[model samples]
Target: MSINARLFYVYRIVSRMYFHLSVLFVYFFTLDLPVWKIELLLGVYAIVLLLTSKLNAAMLTRMPHKQVIALGELIKAGGLAALIANEHLGILLVGQILSGLGYSLAQGTDSSLLRTIMPDMQAYKKAESGSSSYTFASFLLSGIIGSIIFNYSHEYAFWCSIGANAIAITAVLLIREPAHTNTQQEARGAKPTETSAQKFWKLYYSITRAFAMATFVGFLPYYFFTQTQVSLNIFGLILSLFTLLGFISARFIVRAGNVYGFAKIAATSALLCTASMALLGSSSYLPFGIVALAVLGLASGGVRPLTLSNLNMGEWTPTQRTALLSSMEQSFGLWNAILLIAGGFAIDSIGFQWLMLILAVVYVVLMTVGYWLYHIHTAQPTAAAEQIQ
Candidate 1:
């Protein structure tokens, strides 16, 4: 990894640590508030995040990407500081809005900056292929440390978050924009914009894939114990294996991307993801279930890097690219919200087997439709030109 990429990896680890506690802090700190009020604040937070993702896109277009990164981190820090100062519901709501906006901006800008610094496909892949591993590590570390700290005092969690963000902000300042970024911008001239059809399909793919992935993660443990009657010890082992498999799969993404290309890899992973879900749903044997979960983990990890690399392969300007990525992230946010509500109903009313089966079918349909559109657009030269035009 290049210097910038290494710095970015560090930034992600720290940033994830801080964010992992954000919602927990709110819940514990606002324990005296009515449940409905707390829910409303969270709802507002969702809306703000979705809206600000789009706004962040515009900001990226007009301002320096590095400046946007700094601004975003500062906003997030300000939000954490708000909670420390006051525990009022209204204050928390405002803080959530700032936090959401900051995250949207920081995330998109960070990706854009990485692309700017490491423009080569192989270089980018090398830099980012271990992202899932980093996330898993940060998640584990933060979960342990944050829990212990929160147990002592809820305010301590908030303070730690604020400190983490401060460190993240300093890291952001160290990221220097590559000189080639300006050259590329000048060469491309005006930014090429995405057609509505292109945007719609990208968002559709993100939403459906995210929903399926979330369902798999959320339901797997419950299904395993309830249906398979697996021991908790074995279940924990399976989960750990899943994480390890995911990390191992991530290590191979760049090589896989080089051989098959991003779109093809995405299409293949989506198919395998469908099969894995189906297998998990249908298999009654414990060994089969274990293999299926491992396949799910592998496919999930591969799909993320491949899809992101594919998305970043386009010729759009940096701002446009980051904006679209932000939009895709928002699509995920929307899907998660929908799934949280719908998933509960599906699980309670239909049962886990039926729910997985339903999701498997959903994945099949989504992958079919997505790849169909993908082929239709790319298969003909004229169709491709019309899309760009």
Candidate 2:
């Protein structure tokens, strides 16, 4: 990996560590709070994250990627520092919001920076894969360490997270900003390889995927606890298994994308996810539930790369590219906000089985969208072939 790539990898690890630890800190501290309140706080975090992405997009149009990223990291570290200093609920909420803002600002900018350093599709794939690996590792380790530290003292967790955020900020500082490109000039010269319709579908896919994941992360544990006989240890292990599968699959994204193409692979992933939901809804058997969750993880892993590759396809200026991708992320954030809050209530009232069934229906709809994407992908090449002949 290049120096830029290596630095970005370090940044991802620390970023994930900071996020996981911060959230865990808030969570363990707020054990006395109502479930709805906990969910609401998370919803607030998602909303802030989404809103900040829009603000970040506008800022990116005017500023360099490195500056935006560095500022984001520093600001996030400040939030962690606040958490370390205060135990107030209000202060914790503010810290979470700031953490969300930090992610919003840095999210698209890192990818944008990487694209500038190495514009090839392969480089982009490698960056995404490396990011996925580091993120999974960070999440796994943070969960373990955060638990240990929280047991020792919640303040210790916050202090450790602050240190991680500081290190991430330093990594961002080490990365030099890539040369500035004139967005307007590039936009004027860009060819039209993708239609507005394709762009809409890509964003839609992102939104629905986010909704599904929010439902899983926010509600699945409750589902397991209330509806199944799975022990807490088993639940944690199963969740880890999913993360592991996702990590492994994400690493092979580029090769898989090349062999099957983005849309077909995405469609297949959606189909598998649909099946996973169906299995979850229909069976309470431990083995079946494990299979369902595993399938869900595999599909999630597959579609991530597919959707990323699809979003990066088409000719656009860097500003346009980053803005559109950022918009997609914000859309995900919006969906997460909505789903986490509403799904909590729904699961509480309607029961976990029915909730999974509803998600199954949503995935069914997504499967249709995936098929449509596949059709468009196939038709584009055929239309090109005819023109060449």
Candidate 3:
């Protein structure tokens, strides 16, 4: 099979149900475990994710991404098995930590693998692929399936998730290791002038992309927690709005990707997220908050995959794909974790509106940096148009 085909199978299984069980398990066992404990776990989970992302990315660069990812999947399955047996809070935490690590390893690496398998630049060449629409559909599907499994048996969902990881593991084993080839750099036919300003711009864009994702996903828990006290049904409705917008937007991510280009799409998404947060923060009305959330959810769906794809296509040493990926993973995971923890506290103390406003400002600054990344990159090539194309 083509590498893409093999990896697609891997994606189908691992992506499909891994999230399903992670969330289902959390709701069933961990949701009511008290806010403080949950916050502590989130903190730990962030640290664990950073460690794993760093290790996996390093391994993939030095050796092979496929092997690293496969090992992660195997470990995940084993962890799940342990969770099934122990059924203790400690056990569940351990299981989640392991699984989170596994997820961190796979998330960005999987998309990079897909890029390796594509038919060059014409065939959706990026660190990631697909669209916002794709994410929405996948998320909606996972939630629907996961909910059904939970309704019947949460334990069954856990087992089923493990089974899915097994399938991913099996597929990972069969796939060829994607080699690092810095064609995008070479294609530019010129090296970036090592100037402070140029370096700053590159860093700026990456930070912005990361910040956008952090704000969207991180602050969400705060929003949800705030609503929990008022009415559970209202909270559920808001979540449903996020899911609905996310799924509907997924239908358009591919088109947006093609039309605006990935980086532009990501920037637009950042702006959308910022606007959503700002709007939500401004409104006391439940309907206003819900509307803002849905729009923000759609943009969040777009930005995460899009910007990560840009990072994947950067000019890292081909021999150091793993290390580069690891760095990316660490940046994303650590910040994401920090954001969640901080946002949780912000919700408990100040309230969601203020948290959103604060985050929205941050998002604007980050996205502005992202907007300039393209210009800075364009400075790299003598034959800029020919190469970037």
RMSD for all candidates, in order, please.
5.9, 4.3, 5.6
Question: Which stretches of model 2 miss by more than 4 angstroms?
Answer: 18-30, 80-89, 181-201, 224-236, 284-287, 313-315, 366-389
Kindly list the per-residue Cα lDDT of model 3 for residues 1-389, writing each as its tens digit.
45556466555435545434324324533446654455555555566767776565455535555666677777777666766666567886786687677777776566556555553644543324343345455555555565556556556667777777887777776776545443443433433343333333234334544544444444554445445343333433455456667555545664576676654565566677778878878876766866787786677554444444344354443324444545556665676677667776666678777877887887676556644664556654444322322
lDDT of 2 at 12: 74
Q: Which segments of candidate 3 are over 4 A away from where they belong? A: 1-16, 19-31, 61-63, 79-89, 124-128, 131-136, 176-244, 247-264, 308-319, 369-389
Candidate that scores best on TM-score: 2
Error of 3 at 369 (Å): 6.2
Q: Give one digit per residue, the lDDT tens place, for model 1 in 66-172.
A: 77877888888887777666777778778878877788778767777777777786666666667645755564455446545654676776777777787777776
Judged by whole-model lDDT over C-alpha atoms, candidate 2 comes out at 0.66
> Which of candidates 1 and 3 is the stronger one according to lDDT?
1
Ranking by TM-score: 2, 3, 1
lDDT of each prediction vs. the true structure? Answer: 0.62, 0.66, 0.57
Candidate number with the higher lDDT (1 or 2): 2
The better candidate by TM-score, 2 or 3, is: 2
On lDDT, the candidate that comes out on top is 2
Model 2: per-residue Cα lDDT at residue 303: 49
